[model samples]
Target: MKKKKIAICHYRVGGTDGVSLEIEKRKQILEKHGCEVKLIAGSRSKGADYAIDELEWDQGVVPIIKENGFVYFNRKDLEDDELKRKMNKISDRILNKLDEIQRIEKFDAVLIHNIFSFGSHLAAAKPFAKWVEKHKLPCIATHHDFYWERNEFDIVRNEYVRNYMKKFMPPKSKYIEHITINSLARRELKKRFNIDSYILPDIFNFNQKPWKKDSFNKDPLKELKIKSTDIIVLQATRVLPRKGVELAMDFTKTLQKKIDELKSKKLYNGKKINADPNVILLIAGYTEDMDHDYLLKIKAKAFDDKIHIKFISNVIKANRAYRQRIKIYSLWDIYVHADIVTFPSIWEGWGNQFIEAIFAKKPIVVFEYPVFKEDIKREGYNIISLGDELETLENGLHKAPQENIQKAVQKSIRWLIDKNLNKKLEENFAIGKKYHGYKILEDFLVKKLGL
Candidate 1:
């Protein structure tokens, strides 16, 4: 029997972002199930089978289209008529490239990630919708995010651009099936467009070899200049405003004070708490272009509070590899050295880092974002909660209540000192494996694609 050929499409692939990680997992699972998978992307740092330049948002004329369509309609740079002309030209190029690839590869199905739902690359959406329509191909539009959910895309400068997004950004078609990462998004998709979608939660391969102190990843602590006695609290998500990294800093500061008070007391693991035991918050994810200033603000707060925070995105990548003779560590490698993981995102389509912490078998301090409340919390995994409500600061950062932060800090200290810490971690790993392991994804794909 001939295997089914499937193409997984995205704006960018082979990055440390959640979407890229999810795509990689799906690709691996699909291949394991006897499907020949092809990765199609606009740009990729590595591992894309087909890199179509026109499909990327920042390349060639796509940025101009983005600016004129969503940012501002500066008539002096390009009139409305000319803007449409350029949009069509770029769309045509993308369509032509996709058509050429389809003719050669003859993909049985296309799994698109974020092109139709996200508003960033407006031109690519129409071409993909058209390509699927033309070929009558079975397309699964996996929406990681929607335009209306993002503040940047809430307003459109061009009327034509708005209408185009309404029609083609997730076009209505019989060949296309929509999937959301959470129940909240599925409900929103239905409420907004009357389009029902399947909920495919973010999953992990919990059965993979456990991340341990291998020779390549043996000294992440030394590389990051962290002491063996210090508690390493990792914030593994990208440095975005919504990630609520400031809350992690706040929790760290409070936890540090408690550590100071408990000097000479034995920790749960039988290590004596030093008078000045460091609680370093290591941020392992790269900062996006829009969130550079947000990172600066986080740094400023850390400085004011005298909290030790290390920004090590330069040393962490999606996978372990050498860059410029320096050994770059994978996110999992960093996880191996972490004592606790902080996931305080105010909003998320789904929590990837939360699942990652579970797989890593580290205790997590979570903020209970809406999706978590709706789709995840019922699973009964034990985690230190930062509560659901947030208080907005004058600097525009968010904070958990003082009591909640203190409560979480106390729980973390208890967990850190507990001799049975491994037991709790084992429970989390078991629950994650039971619900969100690769088997779950395999079952879904086998049913959805009839593989």
Candidate 2:
């Protein structure tokens, strides 16, 4: 029985992104079940067997002629020339890559991530969708964000985009297996296109060892100029508007006050139950999208509340190895070192931190987003759900040995480290290794794609 050839497509796959993370986990799962995996993406992913053209948006040329590679837009102001050029770059890149692949690496199936949802690079993605349709190749679109739902789409409403998003989607999208990360996305996909998609929520590599830096973990506080006594609560994400970084500071203030109270309760010369670890809320994310006013606003909030937030972006780089001489570190590195993760996102197509926290098995506080209610809340895992207004925030920070809260946090972190939590990490391992891991190249080969 010959195996199937699968191509997972997306942009900027290497770093910590929801689409890439899910694709990596899923690829690992499928490989174990026997699938030969190929990658057709805008960026390079570590575990991929083959690399395709860089996504159109990732190319420097597109952004240089317009916003000079900035993130997100300020309004619905559409720049027709800039957008058309962007679309052209994306189309050419994908068409060239597809042509090359057709000449050589014949694919059995294609798995797309966020391409249809973010149509900036639609010229490329839409054509690929059409190719998949024409060839009758088994394919899946693991949607993280859809066009209608994204705020960015307000800036992209030209003919080049409107055609693919409104027209191409219904006609071509229905041909592939549609999957989305959150219920809201799924419902919208169905409501708009009548496409029945599998709700494959995001997952982490629970089977792998926790990502605590070997020697670097010894004194992250010292290296980051943080005091030893500082309680390191981290907001592990890219510096973007939706992450709600302001809430993390507010939460930190509450925790800091609580710490002072705990210290006061201790008797003279007595052993304290828990020492007040001089609370310090360090926001560890890339400050790419922060404008002067936004940064000023956050600083003002902290100033008003007297919260000290050490910006870790200077040290956090885009890639590992700090290879770029930029003292750069990834958000994942911060996750492994932090005492707690503060993920207060206003909106996310899918929450990457939830899975990263789960995989790292760290105690996390996730702010309520539609994805939280739509995708992960029902997953029977234990996370400090920040549903609305810091519901579990105070409790998860201080309350230990309690039944509901303590037990749940313990279960999630424990599940990451202890393979024996359920019927054995073996079942989880086999499932992951089968459907998304070792046999990824094989599973889709015969069963999913008939390669």
Candidate 3:
């Protein structure tokens, strides 16, 4: 079969976000299997084929989206006439760029990522639908998340907004294939739009070399102002409300107490545990997408509890880069220093961080969110499980039981000291690779595209 020339389109790519990460991996696998993958996104980055300023989620469409009253919860009263005009104006500009690229590239299929699923940019989605409809473009719509699944988008109550969503979100086409990141999302898409979608779980490169604490990243703990004896518990998810990051703080507190109590005990490896081990919760992701008050509240909570939590996302990126001669570590650098990965998310598309933790060969503490219980937990990897139910306080803070946290600490210690640590890590790696690795993705794409 001839190599398919494919264009991957999304609002943003080349970031540490789940969708962007998945695109990078997909592009690698597609290129490896004799497909030419052109990346088309709003933001300019290294691997992009086209990066138009106007296509950005925050910038070019800002005024247009604000006029449509889509980005905020307390939106201004709708002016339908003006909103339509602005939408079309932006839509035409975006379409012009896309058409120019299509003419030159002659892509066999355009894989639209998240633009149709996320409701933040209906102007782009509507124009995309119209263009594809008119030109009869073969396309695949891969969704990391849906707008309806997010509570933030519920504020779009205007009739005009509703009409736009109903008409253009995930444009219907005979030549388009729909893909969802999880089974629950696939089911919901079918229920809401009567649209069937293939369940494509997020993928990782399990065959790649393991990330180690190299000379470049050996002293991040020192940089974080953490003692050598401190135990690093990493919350690798973004600081979002649904991420249940407060639960991670709570778990840290509980684990710290247990560690103190058992400080005198010697491990099987003949190492004495520190009585005052500073349990540092290193959060390593950007918080720009979250509400400002949410970050403030989390910081305030950590301070009140006297928890050693560091928001080190500023120093972390998708890949290692240098800023002013100072080292900007990759997410893998943080993972190398992590003693245990805490994934206390109440919801996830397919839990990219969870898969990442597995790839890092670290013990994980995961909250049994709905999708995990329905799709992931059954696969049976060894993890400290926080059950589905959460107790919410009056202040909207969430918590798991102290017992679960203690159990996690005990399990983490055991894993750390076990003589057969490599054996256990190898077993987990095998399971992760079988379920969520690049080889699986390669086969799926090869079959799907008849490559």
Candidate 4:
């Protein structure tokens, strides 16, 4: 039998972001199952044969979306005619480009990531939806997060915006298969839009050997001016408000106090430990998509709290490479060097960093976000909890309790010093491999695609 040709489409691919990482995994699984896979996106990549400039979620689409008025509070604010005109221009452009791709590759199936759910790039939605429907394309729309779930999209008042969001943002048709990363998203889609979707949790490559301090990465902390004695708690997410990075800062401050108390009592190799290790919160992800303002606010909070946060996004890239002056490190390198991983997100479509921490066999401090509480907690993997509740400030930044922060700090100390805890960490690896492993995704895709 001939293999099916699958095209994976997204705003961008081959990046460190969760959606890009998930797309890479999906492509691997499908290829392993005898499917010929192709990459398509807005970004330029050596792997993508069909890259379109306008398909990106960028300034080009911003005007159209603003005209559509989905983020406005009143219908009167929407210039539907202008919105339609702008969207039509981009739609026609995309449709023509897609036609060229169709002629060249003739993909048997299309896998779209986040286009429907993000609700950005309103311009691409109309023509892309029309093309897919008219061609009766076999598409699986994998929704990571919905616009409705975000506060920014709450002001959708214009009927045109609402209708366009409902219809084309991800057109619901019998030919299209919908999938959500978590069960909560599936429930919400069904409740709100009468749309049913398959629940496919995000996966990790558990079969691979655990991340170790390789020669290439062994001196990363030293290179970054992070002392060997420093207890590095890494916040390996992008700088964004919803990420609740302020919580990590609060945790670091509390953890610093706890470490100060522990320094007097902590013993190493049956002797008193003398070295003073600073508690450093290292941020490894970049601030893109209008997060510069959020980054400034986090810096101010970190300064006020006297917390040390090293922004190392410039040295980190989607993939490891030698740049002009310094060498870029993969996200995995940072994980390999981390003494502790902090995932204090107030919201997530799915927690990519959480699973990555698990894969690395590192002790983690987790904020029990809604998806984590509802879909993930039942498995009962041991992690230092930041509790389920958050205090939102007037500025909308979230803070974890000082008590929860202290608890996680103590747990991390134990994880770092106690040789006995190795057994527990090993058990965590076993559980992670069982549930979130690549084999699970491979098997799921095989069954779903009947490959």
Indicate the TM-score of model 1.
0.94
The number of residue pairs in model 1 that clash at the backbone is 4
Among residues 3 or more apart in sequence or in different chains, the pairs in candidate 1 whose N, CA or C atoms overlap within 3 Å are 267-417, 268-417, 268-418, 269-417
Q: How many residue pairs of model 4 clash at the backbone?
A: 0
lDDT of 4: 0.79
Q: Please give the CA lDDT of all the candidate structures.
A: 0.87, 0.59, 0.80, 0.79
- Per-residue accuracy of model 3 over 87-183 as CA lDDT, tens digit each: 7788898888888888898888777888888866667887677767766778778888788787767666467777878777876788778999888
Question: What's model 2's overall lDDT?
Answer: 0.59
TM-score: which candidate is best?
A: 1
Each model's number of backbone clashes? 4, 38, 0, 0
Output the better candidate (1/4) by lDDT.
1
Better model by lDDT: candidate 1 vs candidate 2: 1
Candidate 2 lDDT by residue in tens digits, 285-309 = 6554324455666777779888878
Listed in order, each prediction's TM-score against the native is 0.94, 0.72, 0.92, 0.93
The better candidate by TM-score, 2 or 3, is 3
Model 1 lDDT tens row, 1-451: 7899999999889988999999999999899889999999976447889888887776678777776776533424767888889989888988999999999999999999999898768888989999999998999899998888877677787778778888997788999999998888888889988999998889999878988888899887887788777878899999989999999999989988887655666654445656667889999989876468998898899899999999999989887889898999999999888888999999999888999999988899999998899889999899999999898989889988899999999999888877788798899999999989988888988888998
Give candidate 3's root-mean-square deviation (CA, Å): 2.6
Give the Å shift of residue 363 in candidate 1. Answer: 0.9
